[model samples]
Target: MFSKSKINDPVTGKETDAPRPSAPQAPASSGAPAPKGSDFKASAPKVKPPASTLSADLHVTGNMKTTGDIQVEGTVEGDIRAHLLTIGESATIKGEVIADDVVINGRIVGRVRGLKVRLTSTARVEGDIIHKTIAIESGAHFEGSVQRQDDPLNPGAKNPPSPKANPGS
Candidate 1:
């Protein structure tokens, strides 16, 4: 059943033919010569960075910061800053959450600041939300106000005057 390639049987001093697999050819549009059989492998597609995950049994008490995305299924007692943050259904966060995109499906007890914020049907939020765009699903429980801002991620932006203050008082 073997093909043309030959192998020497050391014990019998006989040559036997073996089937040889061919290398994969690269597309002509790649602009490169075909790789040798021993060195050829299929090109891999571009992959995004992996998201960091906090499992349901974990609990964190300090600030967390990352330029990449994060998926939290645990509890966190401090602030979080990331490019994208997903709070899982079992998660509970007690501090600020600042990200470019925030999807909350759990519980949060502090402020939320993001460019785009979404509270899923199972979400429970107890503090203010500052976002450029926000959506709260029908079954989400939010106990605080949501304020839109041009730059919700910037800490240096001026805060609105307190509603309780009277200009003459």
Candidate 2:
């Protein structure tokens, strides 16, 4: 058997008296090839996350403006202006909401004004709501007034059914 004192370095092409490390550090522009297993992990390309392809995905850190339909299931601390806005059950909004058609099944701590609005049983609105048409379910809780847009034209007409207030209050 060859003695340990006589070892060959494939990179330097010389027999060294001492045992060298596993891999050699070659100069960048040198024609010398790299070790198979050592280069893969060090020069591997980083895997990137896939891009989003949704029509409306609001991840706003500041004020947001849109003219199309939107579904908010994340936290939005700024005002939202959209044509049709749907606040999912997991959403939390702390700003004003303006939309032509609004549906809320989440928590909102700001004023919501729309032409037509529907508050689902899971909705919790702390601020007032101003709308032309409104609908509420059996378990809905709202602390606000309901005034129809037609009421302004015909002031003497009877008021519509008012929204029920919080039962525990």
Writing each residue's lDDT as its tens digit, candidate 2 over 28-115 gives 3233555766543434476643422122245566667776777788778888877788888878888988788889988888888788
On lDDT, the leading prediction is: 1
| Per-residue lDDT of 21 in model 2 | 37
Per-model TM-score versus the true fold: 0.68, 0.53
Error of 1 at 112 (Å): 0.2
What overall lDDT goes with each candidate model? 0.88, 0.69
In candidate 2, stretches whose alpha carbon ends up further than 4 angstroms from where it belongs are 1-59, 150-169
Report the C-alpha lDDT of model 1 over 17-50, residue by residue, as the tens digit.
Answer: 2232231213442446456764543566768899
- For model 2 the TM-score comes to 0.53
